[model samples]
Target chain A: MPLSTVLTLHATTDTTLPNTMGHLAHAAFLALLDAAAPEVAEAVHGKGENKPFAVSPLTVHREPCPVGREGDTRGASRTAGRGRSVHGSRFTVHDRAVALAAGQECRLRISFLDDALFRPFSEAILTLGQPTIRLGKAELLIARVTCVGSDEEPEARYETYEQLVNRLPCTVDRAPCTAYREPCDADAHSVHGSRSTVHEQLSFRFTSPTAFRVRMAGGERVNWPLPDPVRCVRSWVRRWNEFSGFPFEEDELCAKVEGGVGLARHDLRTRMLEFPRGRELGFVGEVDWHLTKHALADEPFLRQLHTLARFAFYCGTGIKTAMGMGTTVCRAP
Target chain B: MPLSTVLTLHATTDTTLPNTMGHLAHAAFLALLDAAAPEVAEAVHGKGENKPFAVSPLTVHREPCPVGREGDTRGASRTAGRGRSVHGSRFTVHDRAVALAAGQECRLRISFLDDALFRPFSEAILTLGQPTIRLGKAELLIARVTCVGSDEEPEARYETYEQLVNRLPCTVDRAPCTAYREPCDADAHSVHGSRSTVHEQLSFRFTSPTAFRVRMAGGERVNWPLPDPVRCVRSWVRRWNEFSGFPFEEDELCAKVEGGVGLARHDLRTRMLEFPRGRELGFVGEVDWHLTKHALADEPFLRQLHTLARFAFYCGTGIKTAMGMGTTVCRAP
Candidate 1:
């Protein structure tokens, strides 16, 4: 089972951190693992390939969120460690350098792709008396961690493929404020519609810039900054096969996906993320991946595609997930 | 020279027309040509392969533009048939069925790729007395046809590759409101920067939805809607080679464009145009195509690509230029 855990920290003093903080957030995650289990940390850090975990950039709010609260007052769930704390500030990286004043609250979300790494991460923070992470030159003290949603800030997410595949049709029993939100703090895929529903058309919102690596004419590799159905599904399937233990027929799956899925509608725009190598261009916004008339005949592939759409919530889309690109959300509309 | 000619027409009576009017616009163009030169019209209509002309849909405005006015009040240029007539109105096809009231003004733009076709089109419209075209059940009376700039409506456009490539760097003396606009009415590629300057990067604004026909996995044909630099340039090069009469090595040009040109920045969004076949999805907005590090060493290809970038203005990008899709405007930043 995978988990998306969020750590709420308070800045000790005024400091400014670079906008490209995803790289630093990953380092903080490893530091946490290193403190609990150095061996596991070594393996995770050394495996430059797809590690079992990913991290989001440090999201800061000038106005603080309730960090030391025990539980949400609404009693949404037992796992929601902190009560209904909504950080309504802009999560967008607006500047090259972001300023954090003293006592300002910030959040760092870590997603454990595999269960093997979750134990150490859970132990690392739980056992530590006073844990702090260095951001820029300031030491930010970890006040609390949340794994479930409060009523006001419903960010809790934890579900397996079985749970996703067998989930019931919803909307009647969901939170009233189920306004479309990016699962920034939790690992929830936020899947709508039930497993039994004839799921043909699905939409995805690329919360972060997402791009696909395409091999163009003459064997030149280039970045395709578009939400292509085949490429997006292929990227998700790669991770699913690697970690899920249920490997898919890559060639056949790709063929069906390529022929069946069509971009029925979209509202996408290109965005550039400044990476160390250079600027990486990608697209962010909603894309409606629709199954064509031919695809309706193939029932199994349709089920598989829909399942992968939910899985994309946990795995993200395209490459550079560790560096804060490809944060996607799926919905039925 | 390729010319972008816009005809302002007044509706004879109130009537409704379908939003997908590009096909009808093309037919009206052929009808006008048949009235003037049936033999030329026969060759053009028969050569369905790369008809020497393309057309935009009938753009309607409830509030009439000054149609019968002699010249645009701007007094911008001599060749301008009507002086500055700026259609500040939203040119978007808002609804599936658009209603045109009696005496409502509408504009139709036609691009003549080859000089051979421009003669018949020009003669057909200029020589006719009280030229009128039918839209749905309404006959639209041609009020004015402007090929040069008026003071207010700067829609007059006429440029050649030599003119674009040899034009000097501008901005010192230009229209105060040369605010990057989509050249909807004219065949102006709108190239900036002189050939002597190092034109490493250029930008394009796709006013109409543009899509590329790509061969996907297992030899499947799919539509990729984002503006990939190589694909856009290749699309332009195809039309350039077909009509420009100065053909370059296709494979070499594609290779250079693929390996050299990179999408550095963009602000694009997807929109759907309802087509008879189905809904055709493509993207609209701006893209900055920059030269890569390796491209700096290749001067000839660099110069060649910059030329194509300007040519992209007249030829458009991707498939279905004969329809109203792929209306592009180029600029320097």
Candidate 2:
């Protein structure tokens, strides 16, 4: 079964971690994979076109700097000359650190889409004895690593989905629901004679800064804000369906759900976010809108939509979800 | 002493509450006050120009509806007349409810600016027997109310200035800090002789949706987003200093800190929010920035800024802080 695990790390000393801690986590994952099951690691990092694992950006449990420290200047570009100043490229980390007092705990959550890799990766973490993360000049040890919670089934992994659907007639527990492993039974998809419309509310709480990449007229990819809910959901379900190895009627799902769904209401806010590399407008706010369709024939597709949206919780939404940009909490009404 | 207390309420049954539950809480507070201390209630409601206590907006532990629910048509609004359908005014509570599953809990935090009021409030809550809150049709009983934690000191109860100064340098205990009433005194701000600039970073996590009202050029007060670290800090201090009742050099504080401080960085996001009344823009985001001063003479003022900002934890920031819109978590770097 696919698994989602949260690792809580208590810093053993006062430490300064770089801004982009996601890169550090990626490195750690690679190293752990090399040690745990080298073949799996090689298959994932070396040969595979589609990776089965996803990592979220490290959420620092500390206060952020008022003026963000940009430009790389940490240990990444440091030379071995004692008492000498080392400079890095424009994209280098700026001379600022997210300070953690000794004993401060920071948390990171990771998900394994493929069951074959979950146990080995978890084992690697267990055997990695006192993993030390480097942050600028500080080397912080993971005083303790604890897996606080886990969810096995497709639905439970996305807590927000249940929260959403519960407000409507189709409650997560009461309604006809199925995980990726179990296909929807014909009985659950019982068709009624007359056509009827169904309306469901979807609220996305962008837990972190989020943006989408769009192709411009020149065919260059430019960072863009996510405007259409249908497209967002479609992309999310497509990615997970492939990795899940579950035979979802992808085309049918797209045509019925995507083509049928329309925005009923929305309240979204956007702003420009400055990063070390460049500037991109992102949203760190909440958006609530209704996903509505006029035909009862779309009911089964609606159920599928709910299931896939729940999956988005674990897989995350949009680009750089693994790098920690798109952390979303979806709710239904 | 200004004290901040958090009460965690665990639900015993699945409950459905109206969207605007703050009004329900308001009624409960009044009832509780009448039971605990009638004189305090009269003094607060009848005599005081500015109420000493502030109640937060209910942080519903559930999702919300998309299409605006107007007109109270829930079970609560049903008329006794067999054939009659009850209707409310424009923007009536639509025929929907915010539900809480059985065994799910919601938390509400109240703050008392007046130290004397604390005991009476606590006493009233203690005396309250089976506090049944009326939320439209649903009645939610406080299954269990536990005081999870509190911050009482020169801040919480306006005990003194030392608690504020000691905390900044001592820093929430070795890297991890707990917000409470304890005062920490340590060697952090050692005066460096020659003039030098000092920078401090501060961040606030809006535990609830928050917005501020600003007077436009037309002199009409309109809801506005919070701007400028200096103004934010200044307003925060001004409110608490009056509530604190501790005599301090207020003029010096403004000239030294507000005049000297400049914003080094910021990342803020805001969105339009829908309440029972109508639509208003609000922010549910994380803001980080630096307060910088060019001279050592401003160190004392910076210390004062830190102290007051910490006070904001209990007092909250901006308007309706007591009404639940301004709940914030503060941290320093």
Candidate 3:
């Protein structure tokens, strides 16, 4: 048979008791549980249609309320008049499989209840006592609840763990599961699928006083012994549908500077240096990655590509990051 | 004596009436004489200290102003009363060399004065008329004046050649001189003194997929391939100090892209390209020229440098103009 665990219903806040547990105490309890048991955290916090709790999974059993003994009415009346109860609810550990592992004791020894059960109760009396249970049983110990408390400290009043659990409208099984994991560190190698390839280049030009002329194919030309710095930047872009390997081959980008002296020439030189080598530079040195349409159909590949594009946009001009200095000038070609 | 030449000043605006020749008549007469007899465009529109009566150095002289009889009260009274100027103030060409160049029968005519002189005056007139004299003889010829007119018509005004020249203060002798020269057309060889040398270089980087590692003197380090396109631009700047050879030793004076990638890797590649010289992968080209410092310190050189710098800056950054892009980073270094 599956292990049955006790679910404790303890009153965290008691206005009647000075310096006792309060709302902060209850919040701390949840935070501690989350830190200690990530699995429990995941089970409680999992996103779904119904989110009951933000803790891990467990088969919870609530403790039963103690019955009044015969001829004990007078004692009960006296306690009831004082707004306190002597005989409180008691839970027993009957399932050996659910017992805590050795050396894995609860450090805070705190109690937890479904928020839905506690949220409706105005006042309650909480009694935390050692559980009466058999060793090696499949049961695990949890807190018990007693009588209802005064109106002045309504939230402090408590009900039996059984009563609280039974009052809940939804089954524990219906609660969404939380699968928490450790935070990712920056050093981990990024996982890039086969669909994407990253390309990078660095080019340089030198000034010569004696050169006659420099020429490139397709009528591109640069006169030697350049009078001033001439920087040319260009790129090509293609829509996702029209992406082809030869997209950048259709046109060339070109820029030239003439006039004035000194600062103007220097400005021209610097302008060329920062000009985007792709579309921004009139499609001068553009290359198409030629991303296949099939790749886009894959969700993960598409997601990764989008992520990379976002990263590039954030980086801007490339100098700020390890990406160096460059321009973004391509779509899938 | 240096050869003398005759100059002519033609009024671009019409001012052929009399009586309009008031206080300005004498000044205008002096201006015409200075422009014509010397055949100098001094004080010509947009030239030297441009004055009232101005002439174009390129304009050919046809007829000289007629010399009026001394104390010719009849014509003076007629001009003063009618407020119309016929012939403006004029002077004879006394220099024998200039007279002989005009030929025995040739009369030097003044034409083309800027239009600015007539705008302020209501009526413009030439007092003296048909005053002619033989060559090599100095004689007073024309007189003119201006007055307020009753008509409310808007006056036509424009910058006169004399006014333009006058506005440009003479600083050729006082301003610091430099040996700069403007760059000729692409086909023309740039002329430089013995002190000038030119430097240039060209470089390329393998940006496709494989060249992601940077090997330096310290160690081989893998670099994250840039996710964006990269471009390389080159620029040249002039240095002012005199040096025995090239001032390459002055690191600050050298225009360069630095810090993004370390120099060790760049230096190694440069050496490989220089040594045993053959084709090599990951090899880009570079050129450098050294010019005499004095040669770079001229207006033409400065102008060319400014133009080049502008081009470089534009191309490097892919910006259309210098206005919108943030402050330029190009400097003397």
Candidate 1 C-alpha error for residue B217, in Å: 8.1
Query: What does candidate 2's lDDT look like per residue over A1-333, in tens digits?
Result: 445666655555555676555546655676677788999887767633235655654443322212223323233223112211111111212123355555554556676667777778877777878666553354555544443343321222423333323322332222232211111232322221122123244456665445666442223344444434655675566666666655467676666544444332223443343345554444444554333323223455566666566566666666665545565655542
Better of 2 and 3 by TM-score: 2
What CAPRI class is candidate 1? Answer: incorrect
Recovered share of real interface contacts in candidate 2: 0.00
Error of 3 at A40 (Å): 43
Candidate 1: fraction of native contacts reproduced: 0.27
Cα lDDT for residue B197, candidate 1: 45
TM-score of 2: 0.41
Model 3 chain A: weakest 10-residue lDDT segment is A259-268
Local accuracy of candidate 2 as per-residue lDDT tens digits, B1-333: 556554444444456666445445655666667778888877766633235666554433322222222223333223112211111111112123455544443445566667667778778666767654444455455544433343321112233444554544422223221111111122223212222222344556554445565442223344444434544565567666666665447676665544444322233444343455654444544554334323223455556776676666666666555434555656542
Candidate 2 to native Cα RMSD, angstroms:
20.0
- Order the numbered candidates by TM-score, best leading: 1, 2, 3
